[model samples]
Target: MTDEPALDSARKPVPAGTPDADSAAAPWWTRAVVYQVYPRSFADSDGDGVGDLGGIRAKLGYLAELGVDAVWLSPVYPSPQHDNGYDIRDYQDIDPVFGSLAEFDALLAEAHERGIKIVMDLVVNHTSDEHDWFQESRSSRTNPRRDWYWWRPAAADGGPPNGWRSAFSGPAWTLDGATGEYYLHLFARQQPDLNWENAEVRRAVYAMMNWWLDRGVDGFRMDVINFIAKRVELVDGPRPSVDGGSPMGPQIHDYLQEMHREVFAGRGGEHLTVGEMPGVSVSDAVLFTDPARAEVDMIFQFEHVSLDQGEHKFHALPLSLPALKKSLSRWQDGLADTGWNSLYLNNHDQPRLVSRFGNDSEYRYESATLWALVLHLHRGTPYIYQGEEIGMTNVRFDSIDDYRDIESLNHFREAVQEFDRSPAAVLAGVHTMGRDNARTPMQWDASDNAGFTSGTPWIAANPNFPGINTVADRAGERSIFRFYQRLIALRHESPVVALGAFSMLEPEHEQLYAFTRTLGDETLLVVANASDAPLVGPLPVDVTGGDLVLGNYAGADGSGLRPWEARLYRL
Candidate 1:
């Protein structure tokens, strides 16, 4: 197959208002708004300075009041904290820092009782080096768990087997003295990739998944689930695009399909499973979520997130509204028929959308509402990150030493060593795109630690606490939190916005973005001015009579929109 640039390739254009080729087939995610909770930053109830299940349980009402259907916890499982919680130590047990099994069970019960489903973070690609299984695997060649992780013999030149590089920089292999061999890791050295070819490993993962389901947990928000499988032939990938290479390898789908057949199939038809498959294209994603095989319920695509990154691939760039819209349209159209899209802007990995997409000046609130209007009022199951409703911004780190995310630190070092990028530039890039953007303590109020902890938090809170927080927003009728509540409630209550067919109206206009969702006879037209400057554009379609439902600008009536304003109308 030819290596085509993802954005340049032409795809079949999916027409506007066309029903999802199979919308009639029991739409499970039609009215669901997934509330993404980075368990570590959600709320810390134990005063251990770390957020946990107990903290999440204490805030269930807040989520319920926000009108979300489910909570997508980032990862609360036991880990060595190599990649925050992405490196799993145990598939079944909750980390002691977070809480115990009993607390997790109680959390599920409370969430379900409040009509909110709980989806766990499934990090199946790798295991923590400290995990008993990995420890045993590396103990010796003859160990029973030796095949649980990928191990390779040294090359004839006395170097690593392959030229594979880690996502966090450096070689993908780490030397294990016990076996005199190197173990493969796509990410950090402490996170050794699991051998999916091993049937025992597959069985263990499936059993843990079933255990969680049986315990009344709703579904799983799989973390790097696609990485569970790798190209079997183990061929060297292409030359590094930058100094380090592209992180994606080949043949990962085979393992994913087998995993689905053995594990996901038996979880009943209603269970949800969304994969965090970054760098995957529309055609590539089809293989994982094809209706026939059903490997996963949905997949999170990174196209939209790429908008903030500099074109050179290593630096931060100012966000452009046109670029943002163009990227969003691709996913909106690409996945319209084949599979479901896990729509999101701010997650545990990326910076806050309000800070990145919205103007950070005095127009913050208006820009935030504009972003919400643009993201939620579209096709796919929207995932709103915690503290996003209150317009959370990115955390400002003073130095590289102040950062906790391994990826951010690794990139900073690379920028300095390889690219000669200044320390300030590196820190600025980290501020704009670092994981700490989502890792900041949840801003509950202006109180100490932003009401996230009774004591000091593990990470510093974003500086804009006085103007942006849940307490202050909830107190005011015209606040970002209230706007989110209205937006989520509107999606839930109206079929036009939830289950209706999506149609993009104006594609050429830069300032004006218009789309209509039609459900049988009822039609809801969502129009927004994505720019800070006021815009006036032609509405070619006829809407003879309609009532205005919602708008972000003050003077918005039935006909026009102001700067950074949006409106939803029913006709």
Candidate 2:
């Protein structure tokens, strides 16, 4: 399915609430606020300079107090650190840098004890070349596990099997002299794409998933899940393509259905499964998330976040607020009937929200608070990336040498060395969209290293952490952290915020993102001045009888909204 129209709510028999009757029973994930913990950057307990499970365990109380129902830990599994844990070396064990299995268990126990669930990052599309399976597959062509990863003879022209290129800017196929074959890798060469067509591979994946489920992992945030099934014929991608978008393969649904049958069938609907779909449209997301099909509960779509990127993520442009409203409103309506959306402004993969989307300098507090109101008040589940609750801004290192992300390093190399691009422009782009922006250490206090570690950190902490940290924010009553707490509390208290029918109020307004959330007789108006300038608009209807439910500022002036003001009203 391509881009389907916004779901028709009139066809629904259930009261006009969020989702259908099937998913509305969503015991947890529906209205839950999920906090994503980049394990390596969260907090370093033992002073190994890297964050560990012990650190997360010690901080469970903080997350519980933050009002989040769950924490989505970005891959803590064993890896060679090639892609900061995405290139998984072991699926079952915790990385030594993070901690051991015992520590993970303790962390999980503490999280659950505090009424918080933990969902693991599932990276099934590929595995680290150092993994035993990949090692065995690469050992010999006749090995039983040789087909575990995609392997093929070189093309007639003595090149890769197809014109495929890696998402990080290299040939997608890597030649292995030992076997005289090319293996496909959409990412780093060390991350070989798995041969999902092989039933053994599928079974192995299913078994791994079951192991996690039985081990009490509440759910999974499957990474690049849409790329699990590629075009079986191995046809070349479109000309001059970069292997970045979601792989729209014909057998994708079949594989998902099989996965559900084998892994999620008897588990019931309590588990949350959110697919991180890179290029999936609104309609495809519906197919993936409709609970009746037992596929997934929600999906993280990239279109809205990608609006500011010009063609590539590295090339940045000022975002258009109206366009952003149009895109977000479509998804809100598109999935109103069949599925749900995962709301986020920042994550481990993207830049910080205040830096990229909101005004981070003069009106940082107001803008960040405005964002908290806008994102959490939406129709679907909301995700708060580590440090986003405190309004963490992007970091700009003096040079690229300080950057550790493989994607950033690779693109910087391509930009300066191969393309003859100006280093200044390239560096600026990296500062704007680099994954390192969100990878900075969590700012907990004003002490050395932001109190993240007693020793040197693996990555440098943002220099501005002293002022924009948890301790500082907590001391100050009206800070971004407190605003986020209020937002989460609203989600728990107001069913109108949880299951309201979403509709954009003033779609044509340039600097205003105004929308209405309706649930039966209650209708809540959400208006935010998404810019640094005051906005004056005509009052089409008087909001006299409504209660001023939530706002960043205390008193309403009645005439207009000040710069970066966000308010919610319920009638």
Candidate 3:
């Protein structure tokens, strides 16, 4: 909130190309690359259209060879597919769509056997209305479990409790016919927000997490974990929020501290926990991930990704490189002392990085690899979403009927029907910003169905998969997949890459991104030209000669960079 949280008072600024390492305790994940597997689209062993655990298990060898230290799976729990698998019905068992618990156990055992860890998805903020807890809570006014969810009587004139809108659009509070009450849902009406104010709810969530940890899993990637606590007296938002309700609440720390004490206090394995928090700030993230607090290892913040989203996610603008640089640098400096950071560009709910930020058409491979070096070289743990290694592009939907995401559909309807906009114009927005762009089936090979399945796929494979399949890339020595492998290897082999302090070299440059990382006597300079045109820049004048450690362009030498070019130098 203050201009920026002051840097650790004792630390001094290091030179542009110098190493700065403090004697801080480092964890395995700090130096590890995490790959996220969206189970529904990762791979399908059976002939069914949907991907399952067996599919993921079959790909474990591929992931291992990709050089990721851990695999973070999107939720595999039972759900009604309202928001994909985010609306959970049961946390203890595996969803039938994703195979049984035995398959999950098999996947875990095999992953551990390959020296890779498996992290589970933790969706504790809310649950499906079909969940027994919600069913009972909505059954009657005085049911024993009624208080487990947020429920209130309809307004005097018969309406929702307040003006809070659902995250997917429309009213956040849904009317219950039987009980004549309005139940709250930040997401879809089916996903009623659980009352974290209830001690019983917290106990239940912690117990579910313990169950997963006891099952030999590594840890959790908590979904919207910060939205758990609501204002004691639910007040109407001053303005309607796209996703509804307040985020980064004041009591989030208290709830997280209590949850940490109750669940993760005595856990033996060095589990990795990263919360997917959209509305969190750098200062709040510091408290959430501070080592002493033990609430979580890190959090996924949306500042950088949301910079281009004007007003609402559906409305987007051309991304300014300077703005992106500022966002990343702020977090890098803010959490440098007390906490850690999670770096990513693509996820289940976001468009692919290559399409959204980098060039996906002409210089796809170059831009994708450039972005990878930019983020992976940062002072944080980097995550790779499925298909990212092979440079997947955003999807193009022909019609609203082809879209399955609730948020996308709602926005489409409102844009065309309510706002009286042209259907073509609305469709253009959805095509550009919809979550379905990331949800398209993963491109595995050039065979029928892109080798993702023998049968039809639940979602259509990207038409470009033929040129971008994993099989083709893995066979080529100079493919994007191989480049990612080398990047991960560098992070593991060089402690300087993992531990060096981060300082920006050219913060305001439009096409050029340059930064230095320093630890001990080792200093490295990373520069990327995130544009189609060549860029010229000088090497820092600090009497420096350096080795070209890694580069996207062949024989890339000093003084300048080509289009979408990136180079890492060891000084």
Q: Please, what are the lDDT tens digits per residue for candidate 1 over residues 1-571?
A: 1122111111122233444533445355656899988888889988988898889999999998988999888888888787888888887889999999999989988888898988888887888888899889988899999999988887666777777778798888888887789888989999998888788998898788778878888788777776676664452443223334334456466565565665555444566778888778888776666555456667988877787677533467876666766777776667666665667888887877877777767677888887787778887788898888988888787888888888888888887998798889878878777888888899998988888888778887777786678999889867888888888887777656665666777677777778787766778887887777767554545555777787776655545567778777787
| lDDT values for all models | 0.76, 0.85, 0.84
**Candidate 3 minimal-lDDT segment of 10 residues:** 1-10
Instruction: Rank the candidate models, highest TM-score first.
Output: 2, 3, 1
Per-residue CA lDDT of candidate 3, range 206-285, in tens? Answer: 88888888899898898888888776555433333334446445778888777767666656427788888877889888
Q: Best-fitting candidate, measured by lDDT?
A: 2
Q: In candidate 2, where is summed lDDT lowest over 10 consecutive residues?
A: 2-11
* TM-scores of the candidates in the order shown: 0.91, 0.95, 0.94
Q: Which regions in candidate 3 have their CA more than 4 angstroms from the true location? A: 1-24, 236-248, 540-544
Could you tell me how far off, in angstroms, the CA of residue 139 lies in candidate 2 after the best superposition?
1.3
lDDT of 3: 0.84
